[model samples]
Target: MDPILLTDKESSGAFWPVDGDSSLIFLGTGCSSAVPNARCLLQPSSPPCEVCMKSLSLPPEKNKNYRCNTSLLIDYCHGNRERSYILIDVGKTFREQVLRWFTYHQIPRVDSVILTHEHADAVLGLDDIRTVQPYSPTNDIEPTPVYLTQFAMESVAIKFPYLVNKNFKEGQEIRRVSQLDWRIIEGNSETPFASSGLQFIPLPVMHGEDYVCLGFLFGKRSRVAYISDVSRFPMSTEYVISKSGAGQLDLLILDTLYKNKPHNTHLCFPQTLDAVKRISPKRALLIGMTHEFDHDRDNKILAEWSEREGIWVQLAHDGLKISIDL
Candidate 1:
């Protein structure tokens, strides 16, 4: 049987599920270097960054432990019983992350993909999603909807050239993936695609020093907002998400790339909180942690910090799944 979800109303732009609702799930919660210097950089000799140090100072979730970045597995069940889903973001440890989540419970198949940016921690694991296709044998065939802004698509193309073949045409417009000049593949056959029940809303966010990044507003509003790579939310983005807050917030997954020192690109905890207050979603979760963060400590402190603010905050672990109301 499908999991229990809240349902009754109908509308986009709110976190409150429709009267006949659906769901979403978390995949990972680490920074680009999900493993810290000791792992990815192969610089086990280097010291942990200040953010990681502060992370180690907090209490651990004591339940699940994901190294860094995390995403959601969303299932948007409409009032009429139509079901469609989206893969919010894929992380570095994504392969490991999904395997763990599957071990505990069966989840709705990942239908499409929504990206925050092109950072390794978020996009590298994307290759693993190829495996998802084979698992959901009943769904119709379509190129996985990889939703992102024009700028983000450019970054991914440069980084993962093979994924989006220079000759492929169907994927050019998946989610405003730039670098698509007219006539790139003039003679190639058009491979058409569409997501089952997922709508892609591309949100442009400010990252660092003049570089704007893509933060996706999943399921339009009521379901979830996966904004992990942003340092600050642009007015346009705030406007888009503000629209989603009209309903009760199920989950507001956001960036927490820094603990104290503000970053040139992602948000520090304080900035993230400020945005949360304005958005005023029912729940909020922080993601994009660095290796310096010891899952054993920071979570406790972060939770305490969240409480003082009177906001419901939780540290994202490697394999945690949050079933949202509609």
Candidate 2:
């Protein structure tokens, strides 16, 4: 069933049928500086950025050019008919994305969260999770579990000290904040960990020459890997994701920031294509795009490329959802 077609009441809490079908939803698919860029709109020149202009010309619901921070939601349904909503990245634009996509999909709550890195666009929405996990006077609500590397944890501690320590001044005691349970993953650990009954292997990749970021390979019957902020992949990392030349991944969600040129901290279009070929996944969805790409135009290029390579590849936009076997 298409969640998009469901009425608000029909899609509400526990409304998704317990049919054992799991799916992946793109909550946001743009890079840190999301589409409809402020600069493009604020500046007036002879030639305007077509993508940014289009974002303003259409309703957000009808506009594929409209994008927020990069994030994904995995709706994992278990054998027992229970469901788990796993969120990847709570970015700066998290609240906006949630208001639109979560409400649209009728996602009741987030069961857990996984961080790809500590970048502002990746983790700044940590506090807004309170919207999903309401506080109970009797403290019945469990804190939402968040998984991240020690490095990321350290960064979070520094950025949101109150979140880590739960220390608030007397004046702020009445303020409601997100109830979060922090779980640390060992840096660079490749061993798989379990969440919502599925296994996830952390694939460490280079975000920059010195900074290490994590991607994840997850699922049971079908494997999916997500690496939203990677610039380079180590040989070991590549071997693990590709099954050491077996190319076992069913779906690969990767970063592709610019359309043509190289980027220092992100994969450019060519680099993304190169990585897609190297990993040789059965299918690929590009993410973390910038205003440089017009969704319809760029996807046409990907279509031709995919036809030639036999491995499907296309850009993922906010609110896009695809069912997957888990």
Give the best candidate by lDDT: 2
Clashing residue pair totals per candidate (backbone < 3 A): 36, 0
**Per-residue C-alpha lDDT of model 1 across residues 1-326, encoded as one tens digit per residue:** 33222232211111333443565555567766654444433433356354434444433333333354566666667667876666666777777766756444465356667665667766777667666654334323445656555656767778777567646476444322212111111110122123455544556677786866666554543556677778776665676566353444456788887667778888877787788878876667677766545544665665566567665665566555444544
TM-score per prediction, in order, is 0.68, 0.91
Candidate 1 lDDT score at position 70: 61
Candidate 2 ranges with C-alpha deviation above 4 Å: 1-20, 137-140, 167-174, 243-246
How well does candidate 1 match the true structure in TM-score terms?
0.68
TM-score of 2: 0.91
Model 1 Cα RMSD, Å? 9.0
- State model 1's lDDT: 0.58
Candidate 1: 10-residue stretch with minimal lDDT:
180-189
**What are the per-model C-alpha RMSD values against the true structure?**
9.0, 5.4
